[model samples]
Target chain A: MSSLFNDDSLKSIAEAYEKYEKELVPEWLKKLPERMEEFNTLSWIPVKRIYTPLDIKDHDYMEKLGFPGEYPFTRGIHATMYRARLWTMRMFSGFGGPEETNQRLLFLIKHGETGLSLAFDYPTLIGIDPDDPMAEGEVGIVGVSVPTIIDMDIIFRNIDMSTVTTNMTINPPAPVLLSFYVAVAESKGVPRHKIGGTTQNDPLKEFIAQKSYVFPPEPAVKVAMDLIEWSIKNIPKWNPISISGYHIREAGSTAVQELAFTIADGIEYVRQLTARGLDVDEFAPRLSFFWDSHINFFEEIAKFRAARRMWAKIMRDWFGARKKRSLWMRFHTQTAGVSLMAQQPWINIVRTAIEALAAVLGGTQSLHTNSFDEPFRVPSEFAAKIALRTQQIIAYETGVVDTIDPCGGSYFVEWLTDEIEERAWKYIDRIERMGGMLEAVKKGFPQREIAEASYRFQQEVDAGKRVIVGVNMFVEEEEEDIRKVPLLEFNQEEIEERQKQRVKRIRSERDKARWSTALSNLKRAASRGENIMPYVLEAVKAKATIGEIMGALKEVYGVYVEPPIY
Target chain B: MSSLQSISEEIKAKRPLKVLVAKLGIDGHDRGAKVIARALKDAGFEVVYTGIRQTPEQVVMSAIQEDVDVIGISILSGAHIHHVKKLMEKLKEIGADDIPVVVGGTIPLVDIEPLKKMGVKEVFLPGSSLKTIIETVRRLAIEKREKEKLLT
Candidate 1:
C-alpha cells in the first residue's frame, strides 16, 4: 500500500505548509484578522483554515478509498452511482388517516417520487389500537394509523406493492405491521416473493433514542429478529430492518454519535442474528441503513463516507462476510428534520436544499428531504411538493450526478472522513468492550452522552456561538409568527373517532374464535422462544389488531419502563 | 447570565419551587423538554420529569402528589390541544387547577390561542430560547406560589 505522495515530495509539502501557517498566516492576520477565534463544525470538530496535499500525505488512495463498488466502499457502494440510478426521492408522508396518507402517497408518486416512505402515528408506532385509552387524541394525528389489516388495505388499495418499495417507519410493532403488509399483498394476489419494501424493525434505536419502545430490549430485539429471519426466507427482495440513525440525530446526538451508535446497533443486530445459527451472508446483503443528512455540509459528507467504509470493514473482518454484496453499505438518508426552524419558515427551503445536496454528494441510495413547514406542523401539500422538487432540481439541474463520488479525493473531505471514521471506531470499540449497544444502553451510557451533547449545543446557540439564521442569529422582528404560512388542518376528533370505529368494527366483524386462537398461538410462540412471524401473520390474517398481537407478546415479554435520565 | 442570576436569587429567596416537567403524550421528541428541564434545574428549580408516554391523568396526579408549583407539558405529536384539554380538565376536577401549566412543542400559532384559552399559562413553540423558557417558568412558579399563599 504505497502512499499517495512520495516521502521527498511529502516532506517538501510539509515544510511549505509549516512556513505558510507560521509566517504567512501571521502577516495576513496582522493586516486582516480572521472572523472568529475558533472555527468548528456543527459537531464541534475543530476546523483548519485550509487543507492541502500535506494534510493527507500519509493516505494511500488505493488502500483507503479504493474504487467505487469495491471493498472498503469509502468512495461509494456503487460504481456508476447517480449516472446509472438516481436516489429514491421518498417523502415521509402520513397524517389524519390511512386514506388521507394514501392520497398523499399517490400525489407524490404522480409528482415523480421514486418510492414511498410511510410514517405511522404514535399509537400505531407503540403497538396500541386507536380505541385504547392511551391512544386518546393521538389517533391519525401525526401519521397514518393502521391498527389492523383493514386500515392497511385502504392505505395501499390500488397501489401495486410489487411496483414501488414502501418504507414504513414503524419500530416496536414492526412485526405486526409487516404481517399486515404481507396479508394485504397476498389478498391482492401478489406473491410473497414479489412483495417488496422495508420495515424499520429496529427496536434498539427505539429504546436508545426514539423512546417509542414497547417491550424491554431483549424481547423487543427478539421480535425484530423474528421478522428479519422470516423475511430472509419469504420476502427475498424486502429489507426487513432499516437500522436507523435518523432518529438518533433528531434526538440531538452529534454526527459522530449518530454514526458510532448506529453502527454499534447494527453490529449488535448482526451478533444477535448470527447467534440464532443463521449464516451472516444470508441477511447481511439485504441489511440497510438510514442516516440524517444534517446541515454541516462537508462534515455530513465525510460522515457518510466514513459510515460506508467502516461498515464494509466491520462486515468483512469481524463477520467474515465474503460476498461482495455483503460488504456493501447501502443506506437511505433524510435531511435533518431538527434543523428546521419555525421562524422565517421559508428559509428552511434553502436549508433543506443544502442538506439534500450533501446527501447527493454523499452517495445515498435513497433520500427524504424534509419539508420546510416541518417545524410548524405536518407538511402541507404545497410545502411537501417543494421539498420533493428540491431533490428533483438537484438531480436534474445541478449536474452533480454526472460523475461518481464527486468529492471523493479532496484533501479536506478525505482528512475529515478519516478523522470521523477514527473517532467513531473508538466509540464502537468502547461499546463493544461494554458488551455491545444493548448493555451500554441499559447502563444509560449513550443516553447520558446524548443529553450532555444536546445541552451543550443548546448553550452554544443561546450564547450566540452557533448561528441558526432566523432562530438565534438573524433576528426576525415578527418572531413567533407563523400566520402567513399555510398549515395542514387536522380534525382530531373526527379522525380519532373514525379510527376508533374502524378498530372496533374490525374486532366485532372478524371471526372471534379464529382471532383468539391466533393470538393465543402467538403468545405461546413468544413464550416458547419460537419465531413469532408465522403466528403474527396468522393473527393478521385472522383480522387481529396490532394491539392484540403485541399485547399477547407483552404478556410474555412485559412492558419496558424508561428510567429518567437528565 | 444576569437574568438567570436574578431568577436563581428569587428561587433561593423562596423555598425553592418544585416543578413538574413531563412528556404528557406518547410523542418521544423530548429533546426540548429535557433541555428545558435541565435549564429550569440550573435556574434553581427542583424538576421532576415524568418520562415519555405519561397520560394527562398520570401527569396531573404526579403534579398534585409532588405538589409542584408549575406543570410543564411537552407534546410534539400535534395532540397538544387534546392532551392539554384533558389535563386541564383533570386538574380542575382534582381542584389542582391553581398549579400553573405551561405547554411547549411544535405547536402551531392557531392552536396557541386555544391552548391558552384552555387555561395554559404559557405556550412555548419551536425556536423558544432556553433563557425565555427558564424565565417564564420562574415567573409562573412565583405567581402560583403567591396565589397559594393568599388562599392559605
Candidate 2:
C-alpha cells in the first residue's frame, strides 16, 4: 500500500491538477498548485486542486451568489463593493477621560478613520461612574470613562453626530449608553434615522468571556432583545445588536466553537423575537455580527465564507427570511487580541496584517486591526497609525478586492468552506440538542468546550508541536525584554478632581422633578417587562446621571455574583 | 548556590512545600500566572492561585490564611510601584516580613535590584522560560519548607 501511494502516483496527481489550471485560475498565472490542498481551521478537510462546475454542482449564480446586494449575498452587501463606496474604516478608539477620548477620536478622524469605535472603561461598562469606590485606580485606565450624558457630550465634542457611524463597545450598559447617545443626537438636531452606528448589545459573549456582566444571563438576553426591538422602530439606521464571536474567540474558543456559539446565540435571539409575535424580517435585517480574524490565515478566510453561506441557509430553510437583506450577514472583523503577545511586541503588526487580510478576503464590511503594542499597553498614536495604514495599503494596492467573493470558486476554498460548515453544524446541532445557546451557556456547554480547546492547545505548546516563535521557540539568550515604555497613564488627580465637579454639578443642577419622574418610570418599565430603551432615553433627556438611572434600575433587577470556579 | 542544595536536600527528605501564587491589584492578565499555577501543581508542590483583581490587603490576608511557605505575586498593569510598595509595607505591619515574595510581570532589570533589596526573592519577567519559572518555584518552595522545619 505504501509503494502504491508513492511519489510516482502523487507526482502524477500534482501534475494533473495543473493540467487545467489555466481555466480555473486566471490565464496570466504561470504556476498553480495542483496537489496543494487548502485546509480549514479544524485541520481535517482538504480542498481540491481547482473548483469548477463539479465543485458547486448545484450552485446557481443568481439563486446562490447572485449580484451584489442580491439574495444569498455570497458577493458584497452593497450593489457595488468599493465602486460606489468603500467599506467603513472604523478604528476602535477610546482611552482615558471624555476629553482625552475626544482628542483621540478627532485624531483618528484626521488620520482617515471613516467612523468611530468607542472603548469604554470598566466603570462605564458596569454602569457606574468614575467616582464609584469599585472604580478605584481603574478610572479612565484602559478606555474612556463615560459616566453620564455630560461625559458623552464632552466625548463627542466637535465631532458631527449626523455623519459619523459610531460603534459603542458596551454590552451590559448598552441600553444606558445608547440612551445617552440618542439624547445627545436629539440635542444636536440629528434625526434618529440619520444616526448610523451599532451598539455591541451582545451579552451572551459576556458570560463566557469578557466577564463584564451586570445582570445574570436571563435578564441580559431580555435587555438585548429590548435594544433589538427599539432600534428597528426608533433608530432605523442603527444596528440594535452585534452578535459577537470576537470576545468568545478572545476568551480561547476554537474557530468551530466560536461559530457554533455565535450562530446559536443569533438563533435564540430570533426565536425570542418570534415568541414576542415579531416577524423575523422585521428585526433580523438590523442584526449584525462581529468576528475575530485569528492567525490561522486560510482557516479564518474559510470560516467567514462558511459563515455567510451557513447564515443564509439558516435564514432561508430554518427561520425563513423572505427578504434578501435578512439573509445577508453584514459583519465587522477585528484581528485576534489573544494572538498579540508582549514578547517581541513588534511582530504583532505582522500577525495583525495577515489576520486583517483574512478578514478582507472573508468579506468584512469593516475591520479593526490590532496595534503592535496593544498587548503591552493601549495603542499610542504611533502604533494606531500603522494599524490603520495597513488596511489602507491592502484595500488600495492588494487587487484581491477587485472581484466579488474573490475566493468563491477555488476548490480549496469551497472544500474548506464545506468542511467548516460540517464541523460547525455538528457543534451547532449539539447546542440545539442542549436547547440552544441560552440554556447551553447556563449549563456551561460553550465554556467547557472552549476550556477543552484551550487545554489541547496548551498541550501542543508544551510538546513543542506548535511553535509560537518568541513564546515557545526561537528565543534569544541574553536579550533584554523591554518591560517599561512611556505608556499613557491615566491622571488620577485629574480623575478625582473631575469626578468631584461632575458629582457636584449634577446634584446642584438639572430638572429635579423630571429626573425623579423618569427614574420612577424606568423602575416601572424594568419591573413591568416593558422595553426599557424608551424610558432610558427619557432619563437621559432629563440629564439623569448614568449612576442614578442604573442604580434605580438595579434596585429592581438586583445585582448578581458569578459562580465561583477553580 | 548553597541555598539550592539545602532546598533540594529538604525536598528529597519528603518535606511538603507550599507555594502561593497571587495577583496584586487590578491587572487581570492571568495566562502566565495560571500557567505557573499548573506548572507548580504538576511539579508536586502545593499551590494556591488567588483569582482576579485583588488589593494588597487581600494578598496579605490570603498569604496568612493559606499558611503559604512562599508567596509569588504576578502584576502586569503598571501600578506595581504603588501596589508592591503597599504590599511590602502591609507585610511588615503584619510581622510576616521574612515571608518570601517572588515578583513577576513587567519587572525590568533595573527594577529587579530595587525589588531584591525590598525583600523579593526573585523577579520573573516576560522573557523567562517556563522551565525556569517552575524550577525557581520548586527551589523556593523547598527552601521555605526547610527553614520552617529548622524553626520548629
Best by DockQ: 1
lDDT tens readout by residue for model 1, A1-566: 85888888888988999999999999999999999999998778899999998778889887799989987889889887888999988989999788998899989999999999999999999999998999998888889999999899999967988788899998889989999999898899988888888999888988778989999999989889999999999999999999999988988899999999999999999999999999999999999999999999999999999999999999999999999999888999999999998888889999999999999999999999989889878898999999999999999999999998889889999999989988899999999999999999899888888888899999999988888998777777875556888888868789889999888888889999998899999999889999999999999999999998888988999999998777
What is model 1's DockQ versus the real complex? 0.78
Q: Which of the CAPRI classes, incorrect, acceptable, medium or high, describes model 2?
A: acceptable
lDDT for A286 in candidate 2 is 92
Per-model DockQ: 0.78, 0.27
Model 2 agreement with the true structure over A1-566: per-residue lDDT tens digits: 11213446556756666666746565534475433334324333444544544454444456545666765566667777766566778888877778888998999899899989998776677787667665666666567778788889899889999998899998878988999898888889999889889999998887776667777888888988888898899898999889999877866677877887898888999999888889998888899999999988877888887787778889988998898889889999999887876667678789999999889988899999988766545788888989999899888999877776787666566656667778899988998998988998898788667655664566556666556778779765544554443344556557746865786687679889998899999999999999998999998888887777778877877765554332
The DockQ assigned to candidate 2 is 0.27
Off by over 4 Å in 2: A1-71, A478-493, B1-39, B45-55, B70-92, B96-129
TM-score of each: 0.98, 0.86
Residue-by-residue lDDT tens digits, candidate 1, B19-66: 999998889998888888898899888999988989888998999899
